[model samples]
Target: MKLSKKSMTVLSFTLGACLFVSTAFADTLLGSGYDRLKDSAKNTATLMEKDLKNYTVEALYSLKDNDQTLLQASTFAKMDTVNQLSEENTVTKTAKGETTSSYSYSDKKLSVRKSGMDNTYYVTEYPADVNRKGPAEFSNPFKENGAAEIEKIVDAVVGSLKDYVQVEEGTDGGKVYSGSLSEAQVPAVVNAVSSFGIKQMLHDERDLPKIESDIFVKKVVGTAVENKAGYLENVTGDITLSGKDKNGVQHDLSLNVIVKLSEVGNTKIAMPDLTSAKVEKVSYSGGFSSKYVGTYKNDIIMDKDGKFEKIGERTVVITSVEGDKVTGKYSETVYPGFESEYPNKDAFNFEYNPATSSTFTYTDAKGEQKNGTIHPNSAGKVYFEMNIEVIDKNSWKSSSLKPYYDGEFRRIFE
Candidate 1:
């Protein structure tokens, strides 16, 4: 009998009857069992038919060129059994960064292109010649496994649709529709429709330029069961883009997503200490000095009792002192070469001795070494002597030497 494709229930029962009869004689004593098996098969087929009619599937497809570059793409379609048999279907393609293209199908053939490119086109034929190799018995769509076969048709449509449209956006912001399908089918339907609308907008080229957006978690609140408080947790950030169409319009085109995050579940507070402060002092030291020299008319110049007259004295003073050291400036003037044939008649040397409380030494500039003790004066300041040496007579070349000029001193605390 020629069968109607819409009456899958009747066809499934007929097939089940044939199977039961073929197995009836082998289980003559179990005739009821065979009958039960037939009933079960019929029920399963009925449920499948119901499912096929009610199920709405949405899918996205991307079309690419032979070089694997994207050419055009479409948003997901909401397909069901009612519209499954038409040789032609309507699909929307939203190109990345451009306009959207709406297509019309017919005669088991699909064609789509930019709006004005009508005379020239790209096409795909259905019942694809390569897939038609089955036997005559399997050719009848109704006599075959209806629900499973229908699913294959849905898959093929989704696959073809991909070759034309591209997804420009994806989001988890909408409500989730979940539960026993029979109990929550209404909400599920609403969710499916809303999602399909989003997909449509994404696929439409005119909507491309309006697709950029940013999302962030605004605030967080926590509850505590005991006498304590809960702290805010790590927050995350996101950025998204809607794809474009051929006209450079962004549609359902979504690309470039970024998520920002921070460390989670850490809560501690820090405080400062205020009870351990104290006062302290620090000292530092430094200083500078000056000095001069004079020469005798003769080394043995007579005094009151034929004693040698002392004609010169040299001195130095610490100009400044700071911690353990003293700094001073000094200068010396002298007659050069008094007793020798060096050049000038004013040459001489000066020296000092702490044990004798006087500055005295030899007169030869190149032969004598002068030494002196540095002592503090009554004002709690320190001073030392500088020695002068005369090396020439005619031109009177003299050199000034300050004893312990750049020297360091230390204080011993008993």
Candidate 2:
């Protein structure tokens, strides 16, 4: 019985980063023998990440069992860092003969995502958050960490190869290094080669396979070209995993990836032509998720002139919700001059509005209008809110006191 290639297992154990290790030198390798190769790749990673405001990267990776293609994917992205403009085209194929493709373009004002064969455009404004630097960005810096990690793995593997590494001059007056692994070695340095394969699987949290038998690395072959300017123009490699399935059937899974950097600081991303495609304008808004249904309480201690002359408590009890609206009751009481508690109680109904993140409009006890929002804090466990916005200019005390916005509310409901 032969183990099905589709059921191969994957083992992932990458290195731990040096915490707070001066961002610039975080992923630098301190080994010997491959200084030229290591320095060229490492410097490329660092320099590209420093002021990489424009670039185009093409990455292609695939996995196969025996002669059957289990998975294949490719991406080409062109980015403009300053304006956060980018255009990316992607393609993927699965084991079951299913294929999917997408093209996305982001400009200063609109973001269009097109998918499916017909290529319908999903248009929306730019998101509030965009990382332009990290390898995770996949744009300006375009996965620098992966490049860095691959470089380290290559160094470790090359260090183990020693005299086996073949070096030659490149066609561009650079250097070309080539090498291969015959059999998996138990040596720690050679074992680090697992990082190359593991990096592929862990990248973007790709789907992982499950195999019952322990898989081992069979062979690794790669070639990297460094330009005269000391930058890796291209890096290509393949890793083969051989093992048995649950039924003692042998299976061999191969992972292949190639990355090429081009058009550096020479690429331009422009607004896409949405004239022919189906363009849909969208407003991405966050509604009343299960996180906002509980009771919230905060204490206020300021006066009309923003002075600490009064003691107060603001409590909101949200009982129910329907659609993007919530029905609740609130108590705003203030003790001014340490005199008496002037409690203003009212049943409040707030319907969310489309704002930067989250917004709600409501009326106060004295028929005053107000608008506000709440921001989830600490992984959405607690909330910091400007629950008060654009309220009638009124004093808290009969004579003079105040209710400030920006309260720290805790907890949420189902």
Candidate 3:
């Protein structure tokens, strides 16, 4: 599965948040107590690397605007690496059963099928083809020694952060930790993450953007519960990022994650057979070009016009789709002046680089990409549901307008 930039950012945040707990380990954690925690983590890592382990995790992620839930979702995943197989299910509250996905993964390939909805099966090679193989492969942290390397980095980061953290025992026999690192403590974490000898597990060194002084973790809080056998039962945590976007809008991005593990050692995982499955080589072509238009009411009130617009219209143009490469353009124009009942207003063009435009990968309710016509109708239409980060070059500050367009383009010509 190819993660988009936003998804990658979330994954990076999860990895960075894991570093917070280590800060406490390097300092205020007691002698024997620290060893126990460290040993527990290490033992779990070793077992996962040597034996078989299964996990059932439920995660809820939300993005809010003015305390209102702009987006919220719950995900449940069951994975057993013994036979190298796993599956996941997800549901969103707003859409309820309307949008849900199921995924199955094996060592050699991955298959996705929409649950409670469609029949199209989206399949692809498991570990994407890359130059590196085995231990050297940097793609897919869930594969190879990737998991172990992350554990190593976590252990090392915790060990070296001793001087910068504070820890306390949880009331229920678990552990609680929190801290904000100083400028000098940042490198310790970096060095620790690099010490694992698994370079670029999270990101390539050269590709990593330069860190600013203000980019340090403002605050981190976490808790972990483990068994006497040095195995973790549950871990939960939240991290907050305080910063401003390119548009000068100050915002706080908060992420919460929960993990649970069980059935360690010699677990069985059954692999699925592709022989009987409806499998097709996914493909898109230029002949699929199309154009479409739709209309809606304008909700925004402009200052200069001091009027409520009656109508707003959107247009989409798909110039071409060559081979697996698809090209398209989108624009939404709103009549800011007096009532146009007929959408009689100036046209505001929102431009985007088609090459840079994110591909609109269609998945079933199960979230599996499949091969078929863009829309489920005879219209032969292409659709897009994307958050295109467009800048208003018409303005001096080049203000960012991350507009989201969800529409379909139907072929107007042959």
List TM-score per model, in order. 0.16, 0.54, 0.45
Candidate 3 structure lDDT: 0.42
- The segments of candidate 1 whose C-alpha lies over 4 angstroms from its true place after superposition are 1-50, 53-97, 100-116, 119-130, 133-414
lDDT preference between candidates 1 and 2, better one? 2
Best candidate according to lDDT:
2
CA lDDT of 317 in candidate 3? 54
lDDT of 1: 0.26
Error of 3 at 63 (Å): 3.9
Which clashing pairs does model 2 show?
3-249
Model 3, poorest ten-residue lDDT window?
393-402
Q: In model 3, where do residues sit more than 4 Å from their true spots?
A: 1-29, 32-43, 65-73, 92-100, 105-112, 121-218, 245-248, 265-414
After TM-score superposition, the amount by which residue 280's alpha carbon in candidate 1 deviates from its true location, in angstroms, is 99
lDDT of 1 by residue, 1-414 (tens): 111111223222222222222222231332243323323334433432433332221223332222232333333222123323211122434334444344322222222221222332323333343221111011222334344564343333233222221111113321111111111221222233223333333221221232223211111111111101111111111112123333454333222111111121121111112134221111111111221111111121212222333323222433443333343333323334322322222233323322223223433345555433343311223334224332212111112322112222222222
Q: lDDT per prediction?
A: 0.26, 0.52, 0.42
Q: Give me candidate 1's TM-score against the actual structure.
A: 0.16
Once fitted onto the true fold, the runs of candidate 2 whose alpha carbons sit more than 4 angstroms away are 1-33, 50-53, 126-165, 184-209, 286-414
What digit string (tens of lDDT, one per residue) describes model 2 on residues 302-366? 33332344366666665655543445555565665543434454346555433322345567567
